[model samples]
Target: MAVYEKVKRAIEQMVGDKSSEFKVCVEDTRGTLGGILIKIEDVKTQEISAFRINEGDEGEAEHMTMYSVDTMLQRRKAEGIARLEEIERVLGIKFEKWQREYILSRGLGYPIGGRRTGRTLAHQVKTLMKSKDDIIIYPNQRWTYLDEPERMRNSERYAQGYVKKLRELSEKLRNHGINVPRVIEVDDPQAEFLTKRMNLPARRGDGMR
Candidate 1:
């Protein structure tokens, strides 16, 4: 059997009836080198998960090296197990049972936000509102506070304005029953605002004003 076929069989056995609509296909990576991509969809909820198996080419004869059928099968099995664990962790339940109960009960609904992508102003405010105990605020914008000497020389006013904004925001949240203990000011490396504000003329060599 071909390498792709072997991989497909392994994934099928691992998922069982849970992946009735699964798909396994080969993707071209470059000239004479390619990999297999597998996509598994939850039968009840139709939620999809994907995994890949790259063509192994690491050795003295890198181009000549290829993954054996057994190696590909092992990789597919491991990836399938990982996908199940990820689903369980995100949804807070066993994958098999969750599929049978919650997914079937609610037609099609999947849990989101298992990882922290980035901090936004709205997200920070919401977190503060939900906190029961006093929470310290770390303003997401780094360039707002002049904690260092370089920052003080660059744009102290801009930093002050950022702190002022945080204070105002904290006050508003306090009115809504959110306890903000303190707001820690931190300096940002990429001072875009400071650069734009201080568009000073090039200084010539001398003690001239």
Candidate 2:
């Protein structure tokens, strides 16, 4: 509760004068592991966004998130080309590049690798799927998500963001010739999402229904 208060106040400060119009909730996403999930909502418009601060992360990457995919693509393309050229010069092999844009909600997109790159990814995934004899579950990739979804999903609007990401990601995977959707739903009786108790009675007693 103390930690929640501290983080709530910090967010309130960041939100400024309109902070009163917004509601913020903080929960330990993974109990005893210290991963924090923050959800914010507008009272009038009911606009919402979610962010997570991982156990060891200082929230630096959230700030470092690139809004301009063009800039990021340019930088990454240059680095990739340099690496490719070096490999080609030394190994006597040629390479190809493919560029395509898949809209992420609107106005934001990630410039991913070429058709060959995607095909390679599909091959690797197929290899993994068939590896029942040598499968290692929970490989410890340490990939904790941040607020990138809120930024990229539904053009900065959030309610349908998760769904949009799921559907689009499925489409992208199919385009990569992968037969699996990168989304899943677990029906947990203990689970709730984007829900809150409005008032005391609404939370408990007569209004519980």
Candidate 3:
């Protein structure tokens, strides 16, 4: 019989379709017992079963795992564009493309792409901002400035104001048991970089006391 057929039957017989969802794979080996290997999946628990397809050996082996699609999707959805924007709003950081992707990738969600989605997400973040971190005193990329130097100067001023406000806010948040970043250093001369790392939880609704 075919390798897939053998594995399919094994999965139906052992785990059953009602109890599990799985995919099958056939692999060829080079050094160790080189032959067609039939593999079966238990998607509900992210478990795997492997069996060799040789005339002499037909033994099955179970691999340890906790593989569940629900779990994986939950993790990924948390990293959605909406979530990153929420973090940006909460920490009062200007949203950067790399940072959004980083957060989305962390939770296994789709990355933000293009202006339509980006703008929609940005708007959504404004709604989600709970405190001062939601406000950007100086916007990045020069929304309106005469020259690069003028923009940089204005940005520097904005950074200084943002950091000073952030420090004051951080003190208040700390008092209420909200975790804030250490703010090791900023170089706006005026403090303009204003890049701070906030302690957002891995999942939503986690901020509620």
Model 2 scores worst on lDDT over the 10 consecutive residues at 200-209
Top lDDT: which candidate number? 3
**Backbone clash count for every predicted candidate, in the order shown:** 0, 0, 7
- Top candidate on TM-score is 3
lDDT of 2: 0.37
Whole-model lDDT per candidate: 0.39, 0.37, 0.42
Question: Which portions of model 3 show Cα errors greater than 4 Å?
Answer: 1-70, 73-154, 186-209
Count of backbone collisions within predicted model 2: 0
Candidate 3 lDDT, 1-209, residue by residue in tens: 45455455555564454334667777776367876666656453365656564542434322211222234445445545554544556556766665454433322233554444443333323222322233333334221211122434557565455345444554544565544332222234333432333443222210111
lDDT of 2 by residue, 1-209 (tens): 55445544554555445346556676677876457776655453455555667654534323322212223334544644553354334435443332112110112223453443443222222222222222111111101111232333344234234334433544554565544334332234223221223331101111001
Return the TM-score for each candidate structure.
0.22, 0.24, 0.26
Per residue, candidate 1 scores C-alpha lDDT tens digits across 1-209 of 25445555555555454334344445554454345444444332344454454553223111111223234444544654554454334435554443323222212222332333222232333233233333322334323222232434456466567456655666654554434434444345444355447983222111111
Residue pairs in candidate 1 whose N, alpha carbon or C atoms collide under 3 angstroms:
none
